[model samples]
Target chain A: MHIPDNFLSSPVWASLDALAVPAVAVVSRKAQKSTDSNRLPLLGVMGAFVFAAQMINFPVGMGTSGHLVGGTLLACLLGPWAGALVVTAILVIQALVFQDGGVLALGANVINMALMGVLCGYLPALALFRTRWKWYGVFLGGTCSVLASGILALAELALSGIRMPVALLEASLGLFAVNAILEGAITVSVLRAIERLNPSAVREEVVRSGRATWSKVIAALAGVSVVLTAAGVLVASTLPDGLEQVANKLGMPFGKHPAFRSPISGYQINSLGGAWFSRAAAGLLGLFLIYVVCALGGHLLGRMRRSYL
Target chain B: MRYIFREGNTQDGVIQQLDARVKLVLLIAFILSIALLARPSAVQLAVCLCVLAAIAAAARLAVIQVLRRALLVVPFVGFFSLVVFLSGDGQRAWSILAKSYLSALTVAIVISTTAFPRLVAAARFFRVPAFLVEVMQLIYRYLFVLAAEARVMQTAFAARGGSTGRRALEASAGIIAVLFSRSYEKAAMVYQAMCGRGFSGTLSRAEWRPLRVSDIAILSAGLLLATVVHFISI
Candidate 1:
């Protein structure tokens, strides 16, 4: 999603812009290394192709349609570095020429869609394609890329301190999930068609055979998820505090009266005096409980599946 | 499909006369100032708009054209603002809409006054990589060509009684694949043509012109005004 200007707070956009400058530089350097004299024209033509392709929308059921984001597709065709560079150029043109995104938020847009989207899509596809499931990798890459972009966008919105409801966040995630599936299907179809017509056009880097240690990768991913969960709980615990700060800034009365106090109001035991320790204790306990339940469920399911097998 | 290009150079105006480099700098400063604004007041938004309008008038552009182009950002930003509104942040939602509109208007004014080629050249002046700038220039040039080809393909598809459905999506995918192949071949040919003309790796350009005193004066005045407007809280 193109983050329009003003949606992001000043600090958020400024830091993103700062991060994006070096990212663009690194991507440009990598792209230059991979390409030769033909690189400039090819990049240009590829960009034009993407621009033109986006104009032709495809139906996505229910009389609604979605255009190709092209980040994943480009990365699949060109290498990821070149792909990111092309997408960056497209974002620039979109911002300057079409005003599709905000000028000031251009860096955030680039970081979200161009850099992160390509790498997320490309890395997974690369790892997957190394195995026997090449097509599956392509599909997964496309879907994951879109999902990652959507998640990043959500994270940005939350970090902006908008204090959106949980339902809205879920709705956005659900929407992106649908979009990701569509993107995956489209990416698969397009990649297969390219393979049939001109096999060489598909980058070799994507399909290079390498031994991927699945267990290690899964462990790493699991570790990341656990860390992320903990971080989310921590953020959730501090959310009301942030809300109160905003409320105070706006001169609105908040948290003075009990708004239907629960057993654990604001992530703390109400019996406890709403201290930091109580909130932290409640949050950590909740996290541990969730881990225990998940581990137990997984162990039981694995055992059941083994019995059936 | 119609393509929008730069306007006439014959129109002698203050903004039009400024060096592209100076204009680019001023554009960045203005956008930065607008972006830095948090919870901008009505007066602040008005001041920003007035500045944009003044620039538009100085460049002798049609107010209607600039506004119409600026309005294109509304639906995209408006959709998000609506989401924010639904989520119970009314003030932030309005701020997003207003700030984005002003930002878009400012960009429209800058782009409308400056030629795209000169803008690209100005990017080069800022030490933006030559390859990136070259690719951007080529992309801008070939965008129209590829767009027309895509239009023709769409027409042919429709002429054959192509209807929207899963099949249309597959057909569109195939069309895009074919377009990629065509563009690839075209790029090869374009590269060959460039090679035939004793071409170097870089896209060569004429010597850069030094900024004039008037350009510096204009830039200083614009930055001064922008700085004042930026720090004036509410």
Candidate 2:
């Protein structure tokens, strides 16, 4: 789900980055506002739990295994902001320290797996849960969220420079439908467990907990995250996505270069660098920088919530 | 690596010593470079590989170690995007596949070099929002709990001789329902526990030191190299 560097243009990519910077901050703030002090520890524990759960690969049909990407699960327990933030952390750890995804594409990955996945999934699910059709809402909201994440992935790809042709889009959409169904089923199973635990208790624990300040802070963060996410969307690349098979047709200058000459060319925007170590270092720095900003924003939101209380 | 992840282990020495941040940045740069190279000249790709190899060597990573770790994605990528290879022109498809593989491999190198726990710590250090970090932590924690639950449920089903054909599917569905119920119950329990503590709106931990001068120096050098390469490629 992570978009590697050199995959897209700077103007578009940077725009997305710019958007993410504040989106995370605002959302973190919003999430803080809704927090209950008592729920803080539980949320913390849950965060760790989610991280661990991602590592356990469940056997699907055939020899391939798929891990649960419980975006909606977390959203259901905590909220959308928490879900987005948690997924972001997971992706960051996977890419930066674990090397599961590329550094340059960290922003894209965060947007796809964290921002889009959690936000889209959580919002609708929360809505549905709050609406008349509690059970059906859970199923439908979860399904939609997966679709949102999948579409976001496609969007990220396009922004990063994939030229999605009509045929490609159709094929990709078909594939996405399959992926969504599988993921949706898994989500439903997880949510049902959560529901049986007692939604009222879950709600009480989150909203009535002593961490009133925490809730405020979380809310503020959410506000910030949403703003940033929206901004990123605006700035995101307008290029075609993976569904677009028209890379050669896009008529971009570098669209049709000799392939054999540059095997490593696609990963990095620049290929003639002196040391991979240094480039990698820069990427790590950017990742850290992003985290620092987010943390600072969360801290501020916390303080603001405290003052309000 | 053993010191960081485990107290002591025979396989501890196999891990690299580079800070997680350093590895992260390098890998990112590697990925970005790959993404940007577009239709790279074969020579450029070779150079990129050399750089990757050098980093791997510096990190004391073996080819097999990295490949084995990275192979996890091959199935997914192959299942999903192999058509990009088989459907396109032979030369073009070869180019696309190679480019994509290099990109994936670059990421694999980063993962193989860095352990998961440290990676999470690094994410925290970078200042990801507390809410997000906390959820990541919880997900990781509950993953095992759920898996164990799933296993137990499956065993129970099997023991009851409910593991045949159509019944298996029904049992699977039933298992999902069971898993959901248990996880929810557990979440409620966990939330109650949190209320006892003085939890605030924000999750906090000791702040990490910002990137030092040495870190900045290393990063600058990398950025400079990338800038130069980007220009050359262009």
Candidate 3:
């Protein structure tokens, strides 16, 4: 799922590259500020461990085997922020040394696999790790992480104007679903086995049974927005006509002049003249407001809590 | 498994001697130009390819080898382009496939010539965080070792007929668990060793020399070539 160079159009890549630099900085800061300064070396060795773990394959039947994707597993072992930093380092090494991904596409890959994958994976792990449903949460985290990344990858490609037939899109989605399940299964079993072996390895972080950490709540909210954003795109792709009919019932005045003129007047880019364009425009802008709302609410909540303390 | 990057390529090439910072800037500008080009005639594509080949020759790398390495992007891009082709836009499909291939070759060539450690140093020069760069350096250093260890475990497991039953999954997890513990212990040892050597939070960088006039000349030439390619296509 590593995007190669030139696969993304300029706007998509440029904007993502802009977004990723700060994101990486934030996580790197967190990793540095983390209590265990020893985690620096641990991060590197853990990265190598995940990289090498790929060599040990799990048989998925029919003479095929798949290895760990490592995002969720990394989150389980290391905290998500540090885990994200490790994944980012792994990605850079992969791009530069192995040609696994393109240099320009590094930002997109980092956002998708490193940031989103680890955060989404960690949300579930945080929820389930101390409970009887610990393993199930791990499985869900793995699946959600992979699935989230895959959807974002597909959406980016689509926005790049790569037109896939509906059938191909569905087929790829199905493939991603299968891959997600396998990742989930692998994460569950591996974490379980590690828990059994060192007894204390998995419990290092697991013993933290406090109120959901401030960051976890914020990450969960961010994860929800990511899922919503992807969902908006998917919905716009598949159900635009129905949405439009509902819009008309509520009287958007698409061809009329009584109401205020929205920027994308008919949910379409003015320079473009396709139903798909309108759907895409609406999907992208619609959720952006929701994301902003989430951000502001989180900020206010954080401030209020800080003041009370 | 074999290591993918052949380290010796950085040893003798003239391209390898260029300032890593200059090369980094030039490579990015070149790739950006390639990505932004909307449509190029077949003549333009051939011209770009020839120029790329000439650059490879200048680097003392085989043009064919760079082409072959760049073809790694084809399977991934080809599938997308094939769908576009099947949808009846052969020209757009070709543009997507060919342009991305050219861009990939450009990246592969630059990376081949520059040592990754040098590149990391360049990245740091360009404002990548000190800690992140250090972590990346460590990961690259240990990658081959851990990969080899993993291969040995996989082979041992396979030899023991561990692939047949449902137990293989658990056993595979066990392998990763063991790997995790070993890596954890190794990291502890590494930290101690580093601290023994008067380690600090940051790693030391390579000795510095200012970029020479030749570096600027090469960069200008590269940018001019990128412009030529863009306008030539236009």
Clashing pairs in 3: none
Please give, for residues B104-149, the per-residue lDDT of candidate 2 as tens digits.
Answer: 6666665566555455556566565555566555555555566566
Each candidate structure's TM-score, on Cα atoms with residue i matched to residue i, is 0.81, 0.66, 0.86
Scored by TM-score, the top model is: 3
- Chain B global fold similarity (TM-score) for predicted model 2 against the true chain B: 0.72
TM-score of chain A of 1: 0.70
lDDT for B110 (candidate 3): 85
**If you assessed candidate 3 against the hidden native complex, which CAPRI class would it receive?**
acceptable
Q: Residue-wise lDDT of candidate 2 within A22-128, one digit each (tens)?
A: 77666655665566554544554455455444443445556554555677667766666666666666666555434455555566667666776775565445544
Interface RMSD, candidates in the order listed:
8.5, 6.5, 5.7
State each model's CA lDDT, in order.
Answer: 0.74, 0.55, 0.77
Residue A53, candidate 1: Cα error in Å is: 0.9
* Best-to-worst ranking by DockQ: 3, 1, 2
True contacts kept of 2: 0.29
If ranked by lDDT, best first, what sequence of candidates would result? Answer: 3, 1, 2
lDDT of 2 at B193: 63
